[model samples]
Target: MSQKIGILTSGGDSPGLNAAIRGVGKSARGAYGMEVIGFRDGFRGLVEDRTVTLGGGALSGILTLGGTILGTSRDKPHKMPVGGEVRDMTDAIVETYRRHQLDALVCLGGGGTQKNALQLHQKGLRVLTLPKTIDNDVAMTDTTFGFDTALGIATDAIDRLHSTAHSHHRIIVVEVMGHRAGWLTLGAGIAGGADVILIPEIPYSVQTVADAIQERVRSGKPFSIVAVAEGAVTRDEHTAMAAALQRRETASSKEERKKAKAWIQRLEEESTDHTLRLAHQLESLTDLEARVTILGHLQRGGTPSAADRLLSTRLGTACADLIEQGVGGVMVAARGEGVEAVPLEEVAGQKKLVPADHPWIDSARRVGTSFGD
Candidate 1:
C-alpha cells in the first residue's frame, strides 16, 4: 500500500495557502505515488477525523488562490476549547494519526502551527511543516509565502493614499499588519515613498514625526504619508495594540477592568504625547491639515503575488521531500540561497524582525524617510 500523508493548515489564514496545499498534494500523489488527505479547519478537523481525499482534479487550478482549501483556525492542541473548558488535544491528535494510518503529516502555517507540529512529532507522529505567514516572522526563513502578496497590497494602498494626501494636503496614517515585526510596514512604506514609517522594533515620538512632516511642508510638500505597523508604539512603549484592544473587549472582571483602564491610560498618554497629538500640535504650530487612515484587514486579504506563488510552491515541495525523508519535528525554511529544514522549536515563539542596521533601513534613511524618532 502506498503511504498516506495527511495535510492541514492551522492558525490565521493567508494568501498562497491553497497554492501550497495544491503543490504538496500534487507532488505527493502524482510524483511520489502517495495518497494525500486534507483535514479541514486545521488540527480540529484532524482530531475529529473529518478529512477529504485530495488528489486528481481536486488539487487543480489553485496556484493563484488566496486562501486555504483545507481551511484553518487559531486553535492550539494543548489549549483547545471543548464544551466550556479548554482541554489538551495532544493525545487525541495522536489517536487520529494512528486511526488514519498516515505515514506522515504535512502542516502549513506560521509560528503557532509550527509549534503544534513539533508537539505532535514529540508524540511520535511523523510531521513536516511549511512556513506560511504575511508577517514573514518565522525564524530561519528569509521570507515566507504570503508576505509578498500582503506587501504588494499594502504598498498599493499607500500609493493611493499619497495621491489623496497630496490633493487634500492631509497626513494619511496608513496602518498595516505586523504585530511582532515591521516587515509589511517597512517594505510598503519604503516602496510607496511614505514620509514616515513606524514599526514595533523601533518606537517613535509624536514630536519627531511632526517635525518631519513640518519639514516636508517647509519644502513645499505639505502632504505626508505615515506607514505604521498595527503594533507600532510611541516612545511611551505599549506592545501589541491589537492584543490590547482584544483584552479591552474581554474585560469584565475587576482585575481585567483595572488592567484595561491602565492599558487605555497608557495608550492615551502615549498618543497624547506623540504623533496624533503632535499632528494636531503641528497644525497649530505649522498650520498643516492632518488626517488618519487605518488600513487594517485590507492588507491581509488579497490574491498572492507572483513571488508568493513561487515561494509557496518551493516550500510546499520541500515539505513533501522532508516527509519522504522521514524528517519530523522540522519546518522547511528558505534560507539565503536554498531551502533548509529547521527544528520547529527554534521557530516557534520566536520572530524575525528587521535589523536596525539593515541596508534597507539605511536606504530608507538615505531617501529621507523618517522613523519618527
Candidate 2:
C-alpha cells in the first residue's frame, strides 16, 4: 500500500496557498505514488472529520491561483470551539488521524500554525509544516512563500500613490501590514521610494517625520510619502508599551496579570489606527495636506507572483519528499536557493524581525530616506 499524507492550510489566507497545495498534491501522487488527503478549514476539519481525497484532476491548473482550495481557519487542535465553548479537541483529532491511518500530516501556515503543529507532534502525530505567511516573520526561513507576492502588491500600491501625492503636494501616509516585525513594510517602502519609512523595529517620532517633510519642502520638494507598518509605534508609545509589559511580567497575582494583559491588548488594538493619527500629526506640524491610505487586506489578495509560485512549488515538493521519508516535527523552510527542514521547536514562537543595522536599513539611510528616528 502507498503511504498516506494529510495536509491542511491554517491561519490567515495568502496568495500562494493554492499553488502550494497543487505542488504538494501533484508531487506526492506522481513522484512518490502516495495517497494525498486534505483537511478542510484547518484543525476544525480534523476535529469534525471533514476531508477530501486528492486526485490529479483536482490539482490541475492551480499553480497561479490565489488562496487555498481546502480552506483554512485559526482553530487550534487543543482548544477549539465546541458546543458553544472552547474545549480540548486533540483527542478527537488524533482519533481522526488513526481512522485515516496517515503516515504524516503536513501543515501549511505561519507562526501560529507552527505552534499548533508542534502541539500535534507532541500528541504522537507525525507533523510537517510549510511557512506560508505574507508577513515573512516565520523564523528559520529565508522568506516565506506568500511574502514575495504580497510585497509586489504592496509596492505597486505605493508606486501608484506617488502621482496623487505629487499632484496635490500632499504628505501621503501609507500603512502596510506588519505588527511585531517590519519586513513587509520595509521592503515595500524601500522598493516604492517612500520619503519616510517607519517600521515597528525602529520606534519613530511624529516630530522627526514632520522635520523630514519640512526638509523636503525646503529642498523644493512639495510632497512626501511615509510608508509605515501598521504596528509602527511612536517613541512615546513604545516606552509606555515597555512599561505595560514590565507590569505584566512582574505581576504577583493572577488577577493583576490578567488586568495587565487586557490593558496591553487594548493598547495594541488602538494602535491599529495609528496611520490616521500620523496623518493628522503630519498635517499639523508640516502645514501640508496629509492623507492616510491603509492597504489593509489588499496586500493578501490577488494572484500569486511568479517568484511566490516558484517558492511554494519548491517548498511543496520538499514537503512531499520529507513526508515520504517519515520526517515529522519540522518545517520545510526556504534557505538561500535551497530548502531545509528546521525543527518545529526552533521555529515556533520565534520571529524574524528586521535588525537595526540590517543591509536594507543601511541602504535606506544612505539614500537620504527618513526613518522618523
Per-prediction RMSD in angstroms?
A: 4.7, 0.9
lDDT per model, in order? 0.84, 0.93
What TM-score does candidate 2 reach?
0.98
Q: In model 2, where do residues sit more than 4 Å from their true spots?
A: none
After superposition on all CA atoms, how large is the RMSD of candidate 1?
A: 4.7
Candidate 2 lDDT over residue span 1-373, tens digit each: 7999999999999989988998889999999999999999999999998999888888988888888899999999888989999999999999999999999999999999999999999999999999999999999999998899899999999999999999999999999986678999999999999999999999998999999999999999999999999889999989989998999999999999999999899888888778898899899999999988989898998899999999999999989988888788999999999999999999999999999989999999999999999
Best by the TM-score measure:
2
Write down the lDDT that model 2 would get: 0.93
TM-score for each candidate, following the candidate numbering: 0.89, 0.98
lDDT of 1 by residue, 1-373 (tens): 6789999999888888988998888878777789999999998998788999997888988887788888889889888998899999989899999998999999899988888888898888888888898998988889988899899999888988888999998888777887769999999999999999998788887778888988998899978998888767776555456567779889889899789878877775555334355456556655678776777676667688998888888888877777777777888898765789888778877878999998888999999999987
Residue pairs with backbone overlap in model 1: 206-274, 206-275
Alpha-carbon lDDT of model 1? 0.84
